[model samples]
Target chain A: MKKSDVIRAVFHSLLQEAPNKVWQPQHEKGLGFAPTNIALCKYWGKRDIELNLPMTSSLSIALPDKGALTSVSLHDQSYDRIILNDQEVVRDSAFAVRTSQFLDLFRPQKTGYLQIDIKMNIPVAAGLASSACGFASLVSALNDLFDWKLKKQSLSILARLGSGSAARSFWNGFVEWYAGVRPDGMDSFGEPLAFEWPELCVGILTMSEVEKPISSREAMQRTVNSSLLYGSWPKKVAQDLAILKQAMQVTNFPLLGGTAESNALTMHATMLSSWPPVCYFMPETIAAMHKIWKSRKEGLELYFTQDAGPNLKLLFLEQDKEQVQQLFPSVDIVKVFE
Target chain B: MKKSDVIRAVFHSLLQEAPNKVWQPQHEKGLGFAPTNIALCKYWGKRDIELNLPMTSSLSIALPDKGALTSVSLHDQSYDRIILNDQEVVRDSAFAVRTSQFLDLFRPQKTGYLQIDIKMNIPVAAGLASSACGFASLVSALNDLFDWKLKKQSLSILARLGSGSAARSFWNGFVEWYAGVRPDGMDSFGEPLAFEWPELCVGILTMSEVEKPISSREAMQRTVNSSLLYGSWPKKVAQDLAILKQAMQVTNFPLLGGTAESNALTMHATMLSSWPPVCYFMPETIAAMHKIWKSRKEGLELYFTQDAGPNLKLLFLEQDKEQVQQLFPSVDIVKVFE
Candidate 1:
């Protein structure tokens, strides 16, 4: 249903009760939300999403404090209008279709004000888990309005319905999402590690480029099917998972870093060797890694791990932040983000 | 000085001293001898050997029975005389100089009856390690006839002086050369992995064509002086050596395979990324790897590897040899060298 009709109906109903007050939905208030997450170990290929059979499972942490929160409200009034820059605007079909699919479950009636303002500054839909935050926001808004009071884990299911990675954002620190083969999707979700593994510090080195990323959805599908090394996927992932879990327990940097980096390379190489190669690592990305390894040889506790994006996420000592920052180039814009 | 001269001198020297012996140097030796390694793991710069250091510290095995060996002797007769094809033939400076060097080391007379003849079935000067076996034969003939009793290790040093990888031909199985920093050429040569780790099985797959390889000497020099990744050399070699040694201890096939394969890619990548790129993999070689990986996804235990050459060495269980062989388009001509 159109936002105008929904807004008109909401005000119409409210007008019935008060016979005077009128309000309308605003575009700035976005309706979806999800938490932020970084995979300690990552999942690559999927064996079966029907059962969440992941090629590999990874440990991830959810960021809550700085994450986005979405708010949506419906008000009556309308000229059957959509607006951009205070001017009429039209909705995109695919996006609208996707949003409508989720909105239908919460509000069967179209009458309402539509406000969609996403407050979090964290990037979404690229390497970072932006969709997790966005969808989480949407799901949360629906839950808040309906008084669903769903548990965090239960809400994650709804968030995941929009994007698979959202499940990781539901949990706090270090969680493992098992890529199991059980027929029901319920078999795989977030299970947190201990509340704290104090020695962990991850440094994100975002490249300077702001160009839109090739959507992960399309890349992953292409890599999974067209990579020359595609067949090694499940087996390699299975092997990596066993080692990854052990590394998390012991916090073995070598084991953890080596496997993580190699897995990332394999993931990227899948794209390079695809039938139609797709390169996401910019010259900056390659240079950043070179510098990190060069620094690593100098006895700094620095290791880099990448996730599908050009940004170089470095894992280093907390004490070495400033020194590490000094060593890094192309990261001119730095923010002390958690 | 050249092939013809070396052949002539050796021919004459053997006829003079040994009176009727033949000196045959093996053909088909390899040059790219890096352990299975990666560029990211080692060198990085756009320059060369300087940046990435050496593309590899390869581990290889020499064919004991199949490669060539020669015997030579000198006798008091006329000027240096050469005999080959069962007849006295004109000797050139190419054969003369190399044979003369060996002669000077033994029977020191400039003019003497030297009888030397070479019988080699393997392709001469091919990337197949022709130089390896050839040089080893040259040194072996010099050592044997004169009762120099040179140790295999000593012969390796001499062979390496002749060509970086030829020295490795003295051994039969898993061997690695330590490319170290002792300046007077003291710290680099191949050594065998101790016999305790005997599970090492090498599969030698020969590409149909036999062409010249980038002499490890030229390639290493280029890599050491020009590659951007040069600084990472010591650490990379240290890391690969340690990892490979560990793999040796546990005999982990997949780890060893990946490490070796990645190393080979690193070596080649550095070459291609050089000012002028050179490729060692053909479409056929790529196809072979793809086929093997395809089989692996279907649950096969076959593993394949390659050196600087296009030949792909495939390893499989004795039971599955036939099945594994069938995957390649060239099974009919594939020679399984035990």
Candidate 2:
């Protein structure tokens, strides 16, 4: 695959055929990569100044089809190029400042024009780690350039500094961010809560025209400070985490799903009690719940969870996925971007 | 005095002047009494079915001015003289049916009536125990005909059958109905969370209104069934009740006022989660909460609570009363009518 090897092999053919050759050496190159993350049992409070830990266990996040990727080959010598979401990242001076800050946290030594074109399919701010997708793209490219053979956790440590939830991107399947009792009080550092078993799968029903009306950062802090109901929620989170890990071990819907639903409801209930209050459910969102609850009440086992936005993530037993899907045929499935 | 003493006095009066002695008869002389009960801490929500026990503590309530009274004296009566709120109670058949139901709950073991006269001044369910007042009044006159020495508690037991909260009307301040953990469950009778503490005073903010959109009976039942947050609430009721009582004992404004705000908020929160979703707050009700929150956030130190209606029940430390009232000089003030 060496350029010299190709040139030598072609040289003989070129000399024999008497073909003309032009040098015109003028192109720059860099790298690009992106990763995905899934929420474990812990969900962060949006408003906590520190991007504090979750109130309960929420499972199932849809990741990008392939992965975040971009080609950094220069189109010209002097003019460097960058691409994002499959479009050329324009040269904005402010983006320059932000990119530097982003790089410092994501990839310190590997810096330049980062002549790259990016293509990402991750949904932005839809209660998914879009930031991680972007940072993973940038970080993975730098790791390639500097040959920094670091493990995923080490990379995630860099990601965490850029965006707190970004640490979860390093692992696949059932993740947990241990809220360590650190003196510096950073608390959260992500780790996988459970290993993957192919039987465990997830499907989401997104009900949002946009991300959430309020950011998770603002919402969580308000609840922690203003809500009288806040004290009781963290306990529920612990219980949910325990129940979920056990459920994943046993590999059953009854225990696993019931725990997830309880945790999701508790988290939404916390939102309802915050100072100004925010309703995460639309009529359709609740309609979805009614459909699930009715089906279950009629003795069908279907389960769902909701994030800060209107998305309803269904957790069905791998055995009953088709049946559950048929039960909710009216619901529009969200095309998983990331 | 004694029946004979009453008879002698009547005869003497007749001799002294050919007085207009309208001789009203007994058993044969149809009569009834109606009395009002006051709620101190206030009763909300039903616990047991057959016997009504509330989940929260409440206080004893008697007629504030005196026993709530209404007299229905039989005289082959002139149609049906109904006087209330200084207006003739209209001769409506529906009204008659309702009146009869009130009488039927406690008519001396098959007492019948042909004609009657009625009068009362108590305000009806404008968040006032007018029914208690009316029922208490009807029964007091009947006490004359039957010569029954019914204690107030016994009468309250009967009144409670009419409207459970009216049980508070039969007694004075500092009354409590112990929700005994009996096999059959003792009556969740009207009980006082606080009695006649000389320093404990209440100032009401009365508004011009007829009644709430939903009755307590319907609202409470719907709320208990519909609130997903319901289960979590009962867990804290015991603690809330204990804390509020302690606050009352010490006249601790922060403790008492804050707890009251929380309890009232939660009661309404349950209403919002009702099956069809009931908003007990009038537009004015919401505006009041806005004002209080805005003012307090601005360091004005003002707050309010609403019953199941539009009128605002502003809560402030006794020490802050003057300033609080000054902030809304237009709001009317009334006694708790305990």
Candidate 3:
């Protein structure tokens, strides 16, 4: 089935026969913000590509300030206009194309057009989850502009139509995205966990800000299709999701950090086993990982998780921030709980 | 069961009621040579650690001339004397200890001592399967010294008591080790394949000569014990073994190269998913892999397989030797079927 059908069905399920009443615009413009998330238990494979249904549940921690801010308004022009970081995105660019296609799902009979302005604090398409926060904020802004009054859960499901991980970007703390079993994916949405540890910190070791050679969508698809080792990924995610939740609930930094790092490495391991192999690791990435491993061996509570790109996100407690920074001189530290 | 018990049982089963008949030395000194091998379908986890029985069968191609040569003689010294490449191996060294332990299995009596001298053309403990050839040659030399006149299958089983992969180093061409079902591991041994491809070449891209921090034995055990993704490793090996055999029969270079590379990466993938994660890739190893991938994308028929260390073995044909050499200027190329 098409993505639009899934979106409509989900909206109908969420709105309960009031979908038509919320379609009309209540405001001329609306602004929304979303925090980018790093998965502790990664979402690697998808069960339904059209609906962005994950094969297994995942947990993530949202970075409070490093994300996307989007503003949306009804436009009278024949075509929707998109601006990213105050720069006009060309009509045919991949970013613009994907944004327009997602907007088409909610365009109200192809007659209504909307102008979107997005400002991201993180690098785009560099494995920093730019698309995730961007889609989430756009959905949130649209909800406000139309006065849909949808809950965060409904908003998360809506954002997932654009990108899978966007489902987890709707919350500012620990969020868990359920891998719902239904074909329509109505039950799949992000829910924030109750526990919070103020001392947890995420350090960004940006080895490269260049766009990834292959998109995560393409990499995930190839891994699922060709990697023999991908068969065990769902099991890995299930175990990791449990460990992550337990670690967070008890404020066990080492348990949480170790599981997150292992989960990320397992995801990359599957990619490495794929045919034509999807290796996102650069030489510099390997060098940084060795340094992190060595420091950890030397009684430092530092661990790292890599995404679909070359950058590494280090997980450590706030107390070790000075030491972590000292070891990785150029690291940018983010206080997650703050 | 202990390793010694397994060794004794295997010898008893192979000799069958007349075990003492072949114990007399036919010659004053015995010499033997064995070639190192590269696995096309890797053997990762073991079903029985003491017997070294693999969880799945594996395929490999022996690299002629790049291996170990060993000479054994009765010694008058109270302790067994061991020399590797003209240097006396320190008595307490891991290599010497393992070698002496294996030698104890064939001492005939507790008081008998033997002097062993070995020469290896490849680097030790650098993922070049040096131990495989070393153990295989030692067993072959012991067989000659005792005039056992055992078949290659029996010798393979004896070699396995020293190192698992040594079971495949008895021949100089394609070999397949069976993961047999017997509890005693009598059926598990290496057998030579009938088909041969003289055009096949293995190019060695040695990124590091340093000894691996963790031995393959420890890595394999940890992966099996802690890695969730290792559950699928036997299935992967099974699939790759069939594809490799088929590819070899038809001389399908791409199919063989692709399967071999995937199998090796899948093995490493399992290691990467282990707790505390085993990463054999150095920075230079990753840089070299990227180069190989880029070159392949640019129409070079280059493929690579990595073992337990940072070295890469490039699989190409004789026709692409010049191009592969040009791509990796420091690569040492060897003809597999020579």
Candidate 4:
């Protein structure tokens, strides 16, 4: 038997092991899309390296219609072909390695090679959670192509093996990723929020399109290892998560916005305290933040949060979209609700 | 008597209260200069606001000769005339107010008005600690003009009332300021280091000459009152102080430099966690830090620290002065040790 046969046999046994959910290949080809979700209460450090489990529970709003799309199909070639945004990714690249590892999860007892072509509408590695959407779209496409009757939770678990935030991208509207108690990470997954406000939305100020100098993975690990201020952060995050969940339940825009912004600042503080320090905010990022704060002082409903990049994402209601647009006229507005 | 006369009478009474020390003015004019000191372990927050006692003890090295010079002389004018850098400071300006308050410490019974001429060679409010040197020089000049016969420790105490860092500029070589337990702040003052490494020095990179956007006082207060990460920092600082003191005793350059850099980062982390975020490091600051780290990897001995502004001060031995100068040739170099 060839190497592909070996992978096929391994994947077949794994699928058989899960007797409750078995998937047969329905179509040889399919295309799917997954939009990125911007975290309100961020998930920074990880708890399980192998499963990509977060150290703290996080909340985010999904931005649909614009994100990452992946096209996958059975191939005649000896190995999988991984193409990212119209360009074939180098086999040795981390992205390619991760993609191949994720593909291994779906191998059958006997099968041919496969090809995946990805198209990303959002900037990559600039803290927009591009990897999140990329893997989610890839997994969704794979599920459709293989006729995987796997539930949404199972898809999220599979996607997380590719990227931690990818688990959240499987859900729509406001979603929460529980930092579950199970060491095996069986309980860790994203769930759609029960309550949603129709007017909730986000305006993104893309300060820089260039890849960040320090990747989020490296930054998170460094912060977890060296930052003295990071020791008590999980407990603080637990407290903030409770406050944010309550605000979300009541549809309190101001409370939600304030809590999200505070959590983002707390994340940046840990990054700043790390050895050698990880500073991501460019001068333009701060300018955008100041603009949001100034407009809020003038009675505008606006608040800002940033991931591991220089971009400033302003959270506001649909009724004040025009006002937020006036503040950030150049950036695109992403509607999270309605 | 007018208010000025009443101030003079009260000051005289206070001077008389110190029975062990009193010197009648032999000459009615004096000129003094005091160089600013860069804190290795910074003192950010305060405990006793009225007495200007620091929340944590700090260590610094005094930069001599190149600093602020003040020429003070008794005059017959109704109020004090304050000339800063050859220009008369406006009466309502903060500079003028602080100067007048500082002079109130030396007022004598029935003494004539004093005209003060201050020439600041350093950049004010740019994190060079210009205020420290300015107040130190002013106090020194006043001590000479009034012949108060106050000790150096007493001068530091009076200078602290103007700017907390000013207290450290009173001594040359390595000095440490004790954050005394006394509420009256009688024991809080800068003391010269008993053991000094004469070869240790610093080279500065003055990235910006403009005044900082936020004053250090306001930044410290904001961080203390609002930053969630600041609560346990005092304890961490105490631990760092012990480590730094041990390093200093052994003249361990790397330990001293690394500790200083970490302390500075911790300080910035707390500032960044503040409600509005007191960010002082410009992009250039991070660039300079990277350069230092890269150079150190290339076997060059270099470490860095910053105050409340964008400027970066590099710490290295006197033997590496030529190499450091090559790195940052555009900025001026101030020697703190022989």
Best by lDDT: 3
- In CAPRI terms, model 2 is classed as incorrect
Decide which is better by lDDT, 2 or 3: 3
Q: Which portions of model 1 show Cα errors greater than 4 Å? A: A1-33, A48-55, A63-66, A74-90, A93-97, A101-114, A208-213, A329-338, B1-338
As a whole number from 0 to 100, the lDDT of residue B251 in candidate 2 is 63
Which 10 successive residues of model 1 chain B have the least lDDT summed? Answer: B30-39
Q: After best superposition, candidate 1 residue B332: deviation in angstroms?
A: 37
- lDDT tens digits, residue span B75-172, model 2: 44334455665566566754455566555433322444424445544335555555556655555455555445455555554455455665665555
lDDT tens digits, residue span A174-267, model 2: 5666655542223445665544556554566766658666766567777677655556666657776777778778766678777777666666
Residues A156-219, candidate 3: write the lDDT tens digits.
9989989999999998889999999888888888999998889999999999999999999999
- Provide the global lDDT of candidate 3 against the true structure: 0.90
Candidate 3 Cα deviation (angstroms), residue B203: 0.2
lDDT of 4: 0.80
Q: Compared with the real two-chain complex, what DockQ does model 4 have?
A: 0.36
Docking class of 3: high
lDDT of 1 by residue, A307-329 (tens): 66667667655567777768864
With a 3 Å backbone cut-off (N, CA, C), the pairs that clash in candidate 4 are: A8-A108
Taken over the whole model, the C-alpha lDDT of each candidate is 0.52, 0.54, 0.90, 0.80
lDDT accuracy of residue A133 in candidate 2: 60
Order by TM-score, highest first: 3, 4, 2, 1
Best-to-worst DockQ order: 3, 4, 2, 1
Clashes of each: 100, 52, 0, 1
Model 2's DockQ? 0.06
- Candidates 1 and 2: which is better by DockQ? 2
Scored against the true structure, residue B228 in model 3 reaches a CA lDDT of 86
Candidate 3 chain B lowest-lDDT run of ten: B17-26
